[model samples]
Target: MTKTEQFSKLLREMEECGEDEQKQKIEEMKELINEMNTDDFRHVFTKEQFNKFEKMIEEKKISLENAALLLKHVGYCKKLKNIWIDGLKESLLNKRLELIIIAEDEKKKDEKNENLLIDLCECYISLSRGFPPELLSICVPHLLKKALMKGKNEEIQKEVEIVLLALSNIDHYGVNQALYLDEIKEIIQHHQEHHNLTQLAYQSAWLFLSYRLFFNDKSFKEVVANELHFVREAKRELVELTRQVDWMKKEENRGKKEEKELYIFFGWFSSIGNFLINCDLWNEEFAGLICSITRLLRVAKDNYRDIRRWFISILKTAAQKGAAKVDDLLKGGAVEAVLEEILQPAIDGMTEEDCFIFFLNISERLNEKEEDEKEEEERKAAKMEIFEKLEKEGYEDAIFSFHEKLPKAVFHPSFMFVPKNLSDYLMHL
Candidate 1:
């Protein structure tokens, strides 16, 4: 055995031998290989050394436990030579087909072999890393979707996180996800309630899925805005996040995992919120989105500014695009969040246009006088901070100029009230 293999064997066998016994053995093997990589606890194994170890694995009937551990160790080393690493990977891949068949067979039977499937999935996870992603990635999405489909029954639910971990290692591009988009969405739709899935498991899946959707433009549009109804699912997740946040507010001792899950949800929502602006169909769903996103303001403190940007940009684009409902922005406290939170101390990119168009939309809404006195008062109160902030920022001249430009549109300088009509104009579109 090479020095590296010897070390591996020693580490593997550490539990079985006493420290005294190991010391005597090490003394005898002192000449074997004392070299080490100084920067990290890793070794650059030569092909000859790797071949001998590879041959040992091939010839001997190794336990899955040891093989998995050894593979994990080799994968972690990072300094190993490519050929040697490829040799180990090839061995694992050759062994993988048989395991998959056996796991599939067991999956078909009553009282399926849970431990066997679990161990097999764990081994696959170990083998999932390699170039091209085709080495071990091709069959993973099928297994992941199957696991999710049966997840509610607890049959393959145990393997959900394992499959997620396995798939995450490969599929750098979402080739597998694209191939299985419908099934992916189906499982997501089914699990929207997170019935049997753990918070970690659910968010892990969403993190993976969100990355895929937000990245590829075509898939994203199809998944979210097209007939798929993923838009509604986004709202569902946002609602859950807000619910969890409110619950956390009441609890004295919040679990770190729960807070982590909320962050994951917020991260997902915030990314998707930006993505939603590009979709052609911005409708009532967005109105609900506003409230859900606004509710998350307190919970998303870490990402406050970015989330607020997404909020503002979405409204800005929708206002321009003509599908926006301006009243929802006010009712949802989006105005307050923008002026008080995002524009506070004067963000640079917030030129007069972004602020003016927002006011123009308000003026368009104001011209209609649709809001009764009661609703008007509530809008004023909700935007009081915005009003005060604008006054403090000295936007009176800009407001007067914008109001002069839009005489027909309603303009109340005191509360900076402006009317809508962007969405009204685009409604025909």
Candidate 2:
């Protein structure tokens, strides 16, 4: 018989063999492939035999060891390599090889065979691309462990990040049902403490949180709010990122290249704010988080314009919730920041529009504030304080400035002028 026919017959026999005999036949095949010339070995196995091998592996009739041996011998044949990788993935998806077992196997071979670890990680990533729910239970811990492993080679660390990102792409259902919340939080904390990995870590954390918010899962939300204290951690990260931006700016003044770190921080901060607003967990702590952001605003020199705009957008959303949230924004220094931004001579028109909208919302909340007999005096005093601050900050002048810039006969003709009365003017606008 020809080499191809002989290999085909052997494949049929292997399929019919019991486990022990199958192992022996696999060993025999491996030895045969090892002894054959590379060109001859490529010719010996027909496409049908390769397909049968893949099926056997996926069916759990072949051991991972034998699968790896098959992949190793496939070498640089792109078609065979792809087929082997698909078989490995099929095995994983079919649960023929449990994730923990794969992880353990990867750990054992990590030091001696780094390439295998990468290949395995790639398989996990492929599964994650489908946003498979199984990934949360099976793949996450292993990926996090690999990411957090001490003394991991740089290549391994990079592969771990790629896998983490792939896992982060899991859709809302996958995130809501995810079983490794604490472990994910640990990964976030680990990277938060590491100067270089903070961005990647935060990116991963945001990915998970965004999906949770999308699904509106209360239990998972509580995990982030109470256990992870996501707002607090995000605040800490923002502080670090702000300082880094300042350092970068100074370096630029000294003739170094300008860095885009500030933009990156802004993107993350905006994402956090947007996610938090949708979570419906706004409370005193959430207010305090906004207050902390205002404090950051005070210290920010570069990119303050964009920062103020994005932050005020968040404040506006918070204010719309109720009087209490508006009070939170006022107490958080949001009013002062809005006034400051509105008063800027060169502020963009869109930004001024946003600030004006926020001002109107806050004013409406203040008007609707209930008068409790016991707290009447305190409430009046607080309102008086806010009024005084607005007046002192040129609230009228800012309004006039904005009014003067409006086009004549616009679609919203009411917006063309600032009314004489503050409340009436806001109501009209």
Candidate 3:
């Protein structure tokens, strides 16, 4: 018999049982649920039956509604593991969609049976927990769309929260931003001012929204800028990052879970920095962003070079792309954040290449000859202050190491044969 058919048979056996024997039948059913949970299908099915099960999923012959009714009995879904999940890759993706269809069908029935619908959603959670990141494509839009639709109904908000958790699994394997950016953005916009939506729900939608921003696709830059109204969202996320960074910096909060979450957010936040630079979307309204992000450098351990690289990229973009003025950046403690906090902590190798590039941008701005005599003197003082700090700190060593190459980098003739390494040095510096 098929898994569901076997389950169906067990249900029949339970129905036919006398009241005195009901408990025994129920134990048998629990055994079946365990029987269905296995490292390989063979644990539950004969080899021939297992191959047929795979074929049914691939051929669209499985009834997911009934499948959910079966899997829900296995109970709570947490972060599932690897191994068999990957082994079942091809059909497993189809199986996941089948489960979604069942969940949506249950929602449509709206039978007012909260428990039943919730149990069905658990089936999705159990399966989705082990899903590979790339396989997220087919299910995320549906989940977000369901959350957006169901969030409007206050009575069903609990179920909607559970749905959001399913989407939040993107933390394990991030979604491909290009695939569902628009839909995710719409969900975020919907949640921003929603009345009955819980804070948890709203935050989850924004989380949904951020996964889409965590990638580089030249095509989506304009979409992010225009459609997503990214500037507003960028400031909003900065506020959140400020809170999170502050909370994360506390010594008491240094538990393993917090550390794991911190690194995960760092990876996503790193990509956000990339968007700021690659999208060319920076402007003056983002001045406070530098302050908030620079503060995050305080907690970013210097040995984590790539995260530091991404954070510096944001500062570099802010300095170069006009979102933040050089004077404002200097005044906002950017100089100290870059030099003492990030560079000095990084004792092993050169993490300050971008720092120099950032300083070069600042130097050029400070070099601009002021029309006012008093302003000229103030500008010279700022320049001198930065130069002194760089020398006092070891950034001067980086500068002195660049030596003649620094001049050529600053004033490379367009026609000169800038070697690949030289081009890379200038790019990084």
TM-score of each: 0.49, 0.56, 0.50
lDDT, candidate 1, 1-429, per-residue tens: 766667667644533545456444444333332233322223533344344444544654344444444444343222111112334344544355345535564465576654444445445543434434452353544556444644454545645654554444443454644555666566566665456664445554554555555346764665655554545656676676556553424334544444455455544554454444445555456667666666665455443444445545555544443434555576566555544443345443543345555654554554344257976665455345444545655344434444344435333232343234332221221
Return the top candidate by TM-score.
2
Kindly report which residue pairs in candidate 2 clash with one another: none
RMSD of 2: 13.5
TM-score of 3: 0.50
lDDT of 3 by residue, 300-367 (tens): 65334445566776776556644355655776577777776433533322344565566656655675
lDDT per prediction? 0.48, 0.55, 0.52
lDDT of 3: 0.52
Lowest-scoring 10 consecutive residues by lDDT in candidate 1? 75-84
Clashes per candidate (backbone, < 3 Å): 11, 0, 2
As for TM-score, the candidate ahead, 1 or 3, is: 3
Residue 142 of model 1, lDDT score = 51
